[model samples]
Target: MVKVLLILLVIYSFSYGKIITGNWSDPVTPIMADYVKRLIHKAETENAEAVILTIDTPGGLDTAMRDVIKTFMGTDIPVIVYVYPPGARAASAGAIITISADIAAMAPSTNIGSASPVQMGGRDIEETMKKKVINDMVAFVKGIAKDKGRNEEVIVKMVTESLNLTAEEAQKQKVIDVIAENINDLINKVDGKKIEKNGKEIVLNLKDREIKKVEKSLKEKILTILTNPTVAYLLLMIGFYGIFFELYNPGSLIPGILGTISLLLALYSLNIISINWLGLLLILAGILFFILEVVTPTFGALAISGVIAILFGSIILIDPDSPYGDIPLQIIIPVVLFSALFFISIAYLGLKAQRRKTPTGSEGMIGMIGKAETDIDPEGKVFVSGELWNAYSDEPIKKGEKVKVISMEGLQLKVERVKDGSKI
Candidate 1:
């Protein structure tokens, strides 16, 4: 009886202890991919029975997505992708990942699909580009489906045709294996299922198992935030303008410093996302043109061209469908318009200031010829407009002889004699 109890205790220990759990929401940035790879390695080294991947994302970087898929495929542990809570979605890359799991499950009110490959900026790709993208995506999803023993044809349809479905429909069509309302239900349903890992079959024993969640590290969190489209765009704009402002008006270090930091952050983000360099160049050109409009009057021609270039460049900067959907047209249109208006206003103000007459010091006093009211010699005192000044003149003049102040040096005024009968 003691031996029996010992055997049961050993069974329970092996069944319940060391369950690994991971969460992925953003369609897997490079940082997230690395994190997941590490977690999988840890699970394998520790001989964890299950690696639970909780998902809630609209999808993300394609390269990162492929990296995650490779990690999942190579792991020697059962990976169960669970779409949790109400209203959660496993769209785009998330759907492909979900289908790649050993066991795919979702909570009530969750969804999956819309696996179309859009332009990097989330707009519809040109026909040629679209064909290449569609073919690649279809091939990828089909491979995942085959590996996980899901329906390849349906996966292809989903990717090529942009099909979406409720969790129930997905499960019914055999595209997904299960549909559980929560983690507990998932645990119960998958408890006795068999999965192959490291070429060996192992049955899951998740009944009463403790679930532990592994979160992204702080570094990963920061990288993920930087990869966001809105944040990335803002950083790019701030960096560009800051540096430009600093260069335009030297000795102001604040803009330069801020610009450097923003640019660095934006570059890091662009490295992670699919960015077209041509679009970046166009944006730079647009800024240069706008600045030229301020420096040299172009009658709004340069400004108009700059605005058009900037708008076009921004629209084409990133392929919306690449992973993160393109920047919404609504968002891009307004930003372009506002940016154009801002630069134009600055140009107009600059032009107005340039055209205005000088208003300070000696420049303001140039045309005001004053009369000397006292006798003037090369070094004599004179009264001009109620102020006494050291006066100098080549011609000797009697007291009260009218003399016109011609120029000034320090506190002295140089004068010329007023001819007889000439206007003083």
Candidate 2:
């Protein structure tokens, strides 16, 4: 009886569908793509009534955008792309993603469009290549618009002429299905709306439904941080410095461990964002120069070269085409300057201090001038280094004569008679 009751309860829970919503505020990177895929999969597993994705992005990598769209299309449940918070935008690739959803929605005062493709550094492609890319993107967007029953003609203008549309304009032009004030308004407006997916019509029953807001998992948050371009570059630098400090002062486990971890995470992040090989090599060369500056000071020559190389390298390290964007000049300039200073000033002094010989141990007894308390031919007791010890000398030392400690053997000191006694 209990087993039967459990099965019925499980069925009852799934019968009343729940809505799954996620906020996407970052650029569409591999991490974002993965998150969207997981979000949709979670909805499918839970048999959700719908999935609402609130997006506010400046577009991102083409590949990541395509992955997100693919994930949305493959799912059986309805996917709604909502441009929310009134001041948000669905610019560039975001426009296409917005239109590709089963139900495209936007909050008041929001806008969408500008889905044109450009080269790295925001430069336009050559005339020949320009047409090819434009045509390709046009067909992709038009196809999606046609499938979603949106206005294909107006939507394609977003690619051809970089046309943008306000929420009201989008709604009027049939570019978007709904203009909602908020999530609740969107739910109430689209409630019982019918949309065709894979040749089957799906009715959205979102009114008064249980809404489950999905947030990034801890692992996802960490990956998101690692994938940031600035953060990744910082991690790389930290790794280098940590390892450098560890090499200078061995057995200081903390720096070495932190450096290793930071470096590995940096490499992993670099893998996700496309990087220029020349830029990376230049940065490495700069690091090498900085290290050389520490080992062999060149009166700022090596340090200057290192700073220049690092600056150029950092400028080009991130691919211009990367959706994650470039490292800010403000960060780069200060970091390069600080790196040069650290390598030359702190590194040199610290290393010198570490290499300096200690003067407090038994070796400190060497070169000390002390008076011989007892006179002897070969071995005599002498006071040196603030203590009395048995001393030996090749020459005879008279009582009360000055002697210099040359070396130490066990508890005794090897001394020599000072003809002209001078305190050392």
Candidate 3:
């Protein structure tokens, strides 16, 4: 019984010092949220001393940021958020995350702060709205700072006024606990440090421990790609052009099918992100107007309105606070103008083709003078434009009477006697 007890103690010791490292660099998507939850679960199951979250992000969705904060608040594992790699930062939502951690640390040259919340769209909010948002964010940050034993006043300033600080200053002000040059040093400094988590005492034992990396899954990769502004923009254009190509050519299956797929993907992305619904509707309306102009040739009026709508819609399609905000105005303006020109050009060509006279076969031979090779009352053969055509005439004519082709009816040509006696 003594030997068995000793063995159990040894096993518990071996399981008590696990370190789980999580690297988060982007806005927290649902998949990212799940991944973090799984990591937390793994750490708890393995009896981890602490969970280290390596953060390097500009910001992300407010809801996702809140989700991460909720996870941290509920977890038993002591979460240490470390902003590493010298030049990294914890801006926007990252600031909230860093302040919420059990132990915050940063590498030399790294910075953190700037937690002001703005409207998702680029438009500025009213003064009252701004005050409300700032006050709420202040309360949130103050709570996290209080829980982490950091300076709540400084944290409030960081959120409301976008204050920035270097790692050294952060450590000096107790905003962070330590400023390590690298991960190795961080581990050494944190090892054997007693931390209370959920009212239980645990000591870190991270000396010489192996580091494991958790990667995003394939589905997450696809989501990241779709969320990209450039890719989403391209998809929208491809969808519009695909449908347009199908409409112009009627029976081409490839363009139509591809366009439908692209448009659906674009729509799916827009739906997932926090997009201005009005902007989306305006873009759809623009496309419809352009298509109508193509069908009915609206002398640039529809084209002009369509261009304006498309420009406004594209500019406002995705939330400005989102990653999509990186899309340049230069790109947007040129693409909108070019797209409008392309539509107009196609419409002009179609209208021109419709108004032009026929240039092929018997239908093209109308108004050409021809000689009657055989003559009768209303049915005979005539040579017109160097081709023999079945002919009909209201006037009586001799065998070689000169006749002018007036019109074509199926395979027959209707003709009248030429003013001159010459056979044509």
Candidate 4:
């Protein structure tokens, strides 16, 4: 595709910035990191003038952000990060990635900052730990700013105090290199810039060049949705519910299959979210309790405990600060209530089925009454429920006399003559 685009670039010879763009509209994840890494690699391989990554995100995992920054820094081609369109932000890890790029740019109405390292649920770090975290981040951002030749003074405050700056303020403070109105403005301004990469300085010479976009891979696309907090959590619950339904109604086929699929998807997503393993274990245990409730009819005791366990597990399962935010109470509450109700209903059904009389099995005829088709002193042939059975009577019975089925051993039924004409 790049080759084809390059051919067009040569053929058309339209004079402008030869830009290869990557959109970072999603929260940073391992998948996003890989996507950007490949983007840069492709840009370098194709010898493009520069690579521009337009970032628009609230925040995401720190590790994923760092990985993306590492990729941008290692590339030989000039990498540019732009916060574009109206009302976009380069918050948290986005700010870090922006500063790490060779050239940082932002459009009007955009903002950047808020690099504080909070937990998944937006809980701040405790006293001693928070100080340490802030200091470490200060030192880290300071280093990144120094290496990239951007301002570190404001960045330090950004991490410690969650300072946010508009595009104009960022440019004025040297937090970013350019403040453009849009992508076209960015392309025009960066046309004559020179940057040193891998000990070699390259002139951008971007004017009159074609722009190409880097598309995401299939794996990246699927993983992107899995990183969403709401989606991942839903998948997790659906997975458990599916499997639970299957277990309650064994051999139903559909429920189990759906549950397996949903669960696997949830697991894959949770892996990216970096959820607490213990929380996940607790959730699984709670689900087991629910299953036990159905199997043993524990009078709702197990189901109640299961609900508690699931609620707690879900609350702490995901860190509030994770790209996948803490599982919302709305989701957890409904899921728990639904799960409990389902388990209780299923238990009731199981007990009811147990109490129901057998309609057509060996036990069905235990107390059925039939007339003796043939009789002997102690043996006869009896007709019961439309079937003839060999019979043994404890007392003598005459042919055509009604007999009560007392028991059965193999094909023979133990019976006796009806005493008071009791109806079957």
* Candidate 2: stretches off by over 4 Å: 1-13, 120-123, 233-263, 272-424
User: Candidate 1 vs candidate 3: which has greater TM-score?
Assistant: 1
What would the TM-score be for candidate 3 when compared with the true structure? 0.59
Candidate 3: 10-residue stretch with minimal lDDT? 318-327
The residue-level lDDT of candidate 1 at 10 comes to 95
What tens-digit string does per-residue lDDT give for candidate 3 at 68-171?
87887788888888998889999888888887887789999999988788655334568998999888888888877777789998888897788999999988
Candidate with the larger lDDT of 3 and 4 = 4
- How does candidate 4 score on lDDT? 0.81
Ranking by TM-score: 1, 4, 2, 3
**Stronger candidate by TM-score (1 vs 2):** 1
In terms of lDDT, the best-performing candidate is 2
Flag regions of model 4 displaced more than 4 Å.
Answer: 1-18, 272-424
What's the true lDDT of residue 266 in model 3? Answer: 80
Model 2: lowest-lDDT 10 consecutive positions:
316-325
Which model, 2 or 3, shows the larger lDDT? 2
lDDT by residue for model 1 over 1-424, one digit each (tens)?
9999999999977755567898776755666676677678767767787888889988877887888888888877888999877799998888888888889998878998888887556888889988998998888887778777888887887888888889898898898888897788888889999976657887987777666777875445756787887888999999899999989997455576567557756776778333455457557767876776777656776677677657756665663224463456688778878877888888888889887756545444334445655656566776665677778888876566666666777777777767772434
